[model samples]
Target: MPTTGRVRHAAPGLGHSGVVTVTGQLGEFLRARRARLRPEDVGLGALPGRRRVTGLRREELAQLAGVSVSYYTRLEQGQSVNASDAVLDALAGALRLDDHERTHLRELASRRPRPLRRPPAERVNAMTLDLVRSMENVPTLVLGRRTDVLAWNPLGHALLASHLDPTAPERPADRPNVARMLFLDPHCRDLYVDWDRKARGVVANLRLIAGRHPEDALLASLVGELSVKSPEFVALWGDHRVKPCEGATYRLRHPLVGELTVTQQALSLPHSPEQSVLVVTAEQGSSSQDTLRLLGRFTVTS
Candidate 1:
């Protein structure tokens, strides 16, 4: 299962208010990464005596990263505030973090904690809306930073979420979040042929976004709601993976069209970097393409 991983301990320094600060989240990320490694995995031999800790001990990770044990412990405890680039890079290397995770680590370590505030609702510009609407053949939708469907062509809505109202995106309050639907809505969950892979990808993307916008109140609320409502979401989020939403080929089991494989590509807008237009396409002349055309016809007729 994509979500399979050791559950991480609750982030230290979380107070009665349960607000997670930037430094605290940074520490939590580090601890989660550290817990996934073992002594032999990093070229260190097993020490004598039965090991009590799950993965590498704090001292062991500190030794691997060439930092003092006490200093590393302080960092993990959210007591250290000024970790330099060199230190962060060393930690990333020690943990074997990929490019996305490395970037997330740096973002968490360097960001100043901000007071939680709801951001202005995301809106698709007229030019972008025009572009999306022009894609008559492709299944295309505009997604906000939180994976909210900001706008979608008729075919996009029919293919990805036909059960949802076609005009839901027009109302900010009624806009559907892809992540929420994937975990909580049975219709959305049944659409994916590989639900676990899609779920992990969604969670990983959310993790990266969370690192970048820690003070986003709406994002926090979405995460909190998912955590409480879905245990699978809790498991995936606790794994601390970070991935950018890029192009991927997915096998979808659409309710109306049955099974079809489509390549989903994300295009980021220059004016709105946080919002992306997702375009779904099938290989030319493939049966999936024929299926998509049929779905488009249904969308038009209905």
Candidate 2:
């Protein structure tokens, strides 16, 4: 049985060696970036003419992060591969990395590369389809690990992806990944009021997903497309920011139902690691709720 859980993305450019895995690439990437940063960059004054290496010595960084020098060296060499989230956090602080770099570090350290799998002709299960069909009142969507819209309720189609051709969702070749839509789609760009914040979150979540599934060709393609189409996404990707996403308040300016404030929740299934069910709900009695209700009615009628 396929693991029914939200898929996590691996750190970018980590694939190399015999496997081209993110873990190896991440190790090399961190080593290179760390070597480029001078002692001055992290507020340490260089000792004149005595330093052998280009950047902060492994020992020095280990001292700052309060870890053993040998352990840190192993990490740089990709020998000590398994890293806890807390250790990654400590390294981020020791390196004086900004928010984006820190997130990237975590992604590189934590994400697992994907396995080769035959693309299922039908990925979404019948039970999931039934569940979405039953949710006529709330906007619900079933997304594959690659961010493909495998299934959605009618309102979900209208609320989240109105710009996509109706037939696109049903066709694997034509379908749009949610991450791709958020950054590459002009309509999606204009849908959110806080586009920048939303973009960061989207990129961060992508980072998380990429960390976990480095071999997913569909995901890699989506990343490549967004990198080419959206400069903001490109910049963010370069910075290597990453974060796990949960329920969050989002403001959407809908054309038909007017503006609505919604809380988006992602629910993962225990058996499927590559799938998640996301639902957007409005708070009770608020204008946003009224707006959502209106949108729901309009979507159903249409």
lDDT against the true structure, per candidate, is 0.86, 0.72
- TM-scores for all predictions: 0.93, 0.74
- Model 1 agreement with the true structure over 107-206: per-residue lDDT tens digits: 8888876655567788889999999989988999999999999999999999999888999999999999999999999999999999999999999999
- After TM-score superposition, the amount by which residue 289's alpha carbon in candidate 1 deviates from its true location, in angstroms, is 0.8
**Model 2 lDDT per residue over 1-302, tens place:** 43222223332453322133665657655665567667777777665567888677777778667889888888877677778777888888877777766766776776565553334444777778888889999999887776788878888989988867766767877876788888777888888998888888877777667666665555665676666667787777765555656678999987777688999988887767678898999999999988888887888778
Residue 52 alpha-carbon offset, candidate 1, angstroms: 1.9
Candidate 1, residue 110: how far the Cα is off, in Å:
0.9
Q: What value does the lDDT take at residue 290 in candidate 1? A: 99
